[model samples]
Target: METLIVLDLDETLLYAVQNKLERDEDFKMGSYFIYKRPYLDHFLTLLARDFKLAIWSSADDVYVKQLVERIKPAHITFEFVWGRSRTTKKRKSVTDDYYFVKRLSKIKQKGFKLERTLIIDDTAEKSMLNYGNAVQVAEFTGDPVDDELLQLSNYLQTLKDAENVRIIEKRFWRNG
Candidate 1:
């Protein structure tokens, strides 16, 4: 069975920096430079074999589109893309910045199975709506030695035929 993998762009896959001065390994995406996580291309290729990919980001549409265009090649492209407007707006608890919640129910409404869907986000709060279906990761920020994706790919490979992703995620991906 093919699972749906919902990915968050910033922090999860890459870190975007607006100041060119701070960027050494730059992936130019319009006005910003994005630093893709280590082994990104290999990770994507692995995932493409077993699951349909989708990008769901809190960033604006234009920025998300530009990043996707730069990051994805011919063999790997998102099955669908969702941007800031697709997220649910929530009031800020401690700061002026409001939180954007990724409602997995929206994806479910579009016919993606909740049992087979897995959300990969760095922020734990982003998975509030579908906690059981999420596999949280430590936020990536241009670490050359980072092998989180490589490890995740191995874990996911074991769950390629899982009837429900939640059980596998809880068993193998929960906590530290």
Candidate 2:
């Protein structure tokens, strides 16, 4: 039973903001400043060992690809990479930024079953369509001490053998 772990880029795995500072940790990629979350590489390495990995970010292709390349090197593996083009176009609200939603229904069209798939994103609204299979983590904002990824890895390890991902997610959501 292979479980799919869908990761969000941008503020979830890394935080990209205006690069006007002189911080050595800041990666000036193109027009934005990107910072790797604390223990990012280790977290990815641990998760990749137990579950099939994939990236499903709302960022544009060029941006997402660049970020993925930086984070997951050749040795690290990813089953799929989906950008804004593959997501459902939906706005958070009238006054909110227009974000493409990660619709599990659409992902199912690509052969990924909801019961075996889990999505981790900072924005709860982005995963609203598949909230049961989503783990809403605290948005990564370049904090050097941030440990959300490590914590998430521990939680996922517990679910790796579960019959259904949603059952475990439901329990967490209730307690959360």
Candidate 3:
């Protein structure tokens, strides 16, 4: 079976802002500007060949659905598209601030093996419960020259066939 890769939307794949960036926005949604990460199309196309993809964001359910519809390639079909409603709310120990977390156990309940699952997200707090399965990427804020997706694509290729991805060290993935 192919590895299951659950992707984050806000900063991992696209940067959405209310104010416009110096460069023109790729598209607009309501009052926000959405900028697609550099090489996003190519990255998705490449990974779709070797992995079962899904979208899970902590943003509004309706917004997440709309954004995915706009950005996803017609040929690429995600295993699931989830939003804030799917996350578990937790309070931070130090700051007492509430945040949402994506528990991989939900995916496991859906029949995917934890050892072969990966979640690509920019915020560490969101995936704190599953560090071993998390692949942290830099937050994207509409940098026209950003190449995170390109670098990530190359790194992921090395793990496509891993017997147990959770055992691999992914903290230094950029250097992989």
Candidate 4:
């Protein structure tokens, strides 16, 4: 079976802001400007070849669906596209602020094994419940020259054949 790579939306794959950046926005949605991460298209294309992809964001369901439709390549198909409604809301102990969490157990309920599942996200607090299965990436806030996706794609390729992804030390993946 191919590895199931679950991606976060807001700051992981793309950055949506109410105010426009100095660089041109990729598209506009409602009152926000959407900026695709640098190399997003190439990254998705390359990963689609070796992994089964999915989108699970903390954003609104309708917005997530619409935004994904706009960004996704015509040739690519995701295993699933989920939104805030599907996540579990939790409170942060330190800040006492509520946030959405994407529980890996939810994916397990859908028949994908945790051993072969990975969630790429920028916020550690959201995936704290499943640290072993999370790959933390730097937050993208519409930086036009950012190359995180390029480096991330190279890093992910190394784990394409791992039997149990949960055991891998992904915290320092950028250095590896």
lDDT of each: 0.83, 0.82, 0.95, 0.94
Put the candidates in lDDT order, highest first: 3, 4, 1, 2
lDDT of 1 by residue, 1-176 (tens): 59999999998998887765443865676667778888888999989998989999988987888888878867887878888989998877778778889999898777889889999889977778888788888799777788889888887777778889876645345332
Model 1, runs deviating above 4 Å: 20-23, 93-96, 169-176
Encode model 3's per-residue lDDT on 1-176: one tens digit a residue. Answer: 99999999999999999999988998999999999999999999999999999999999999999999999999999999999999999988999899999999999778899899999999999998998899999999899999999999999999999989999999999976
**lDDT over C-alpha atoms for residue 165 of model 2:** 83
Each candidate's number of clashing pairs is 0, 0, 0, 0
Comparison by lDDT, 3 against 4, better one:
3
| Candidate topping lDDT | 3
Report the CA-based lDDT of candidate 3 relative to the real structure.
0.95
RMSD (CA, Å), candidate 4 to true, equals: 0.9
What does candidate 4's lDDT look like per residue over 34-62, in tens digits? Answer: 99999999999999999999999999999
lDDT of model number 4: 0.94
Question: What RMSD does model 3 have?
Answer: 0.8
Q: Could you give me the TM-score of model 1 versus the true structure?
A: 0.90
Which of 2 and 4 is ahead in lDDT?
4
Q: Name the weakest run of 10 consecutive residues (lDDT summed) in model 3.
A: 107-116
**lDDT of candidate model 1 versus the reference:** 0.83
Query: Per-residue lDDT of 1-176 in model 2, one digit per residue for the tens?
Result: 68888999988988888754446565778877888888788888888888889998998887788889888856778988889988888765768867678887776777878899999899887898886798888888777778887777887888888768886645354234
- TM value for model 3: 0.98
Q: Which stretches of candidate 2 lie over 4 Å from their true place?
A: 20-22, 92-97, 170-176
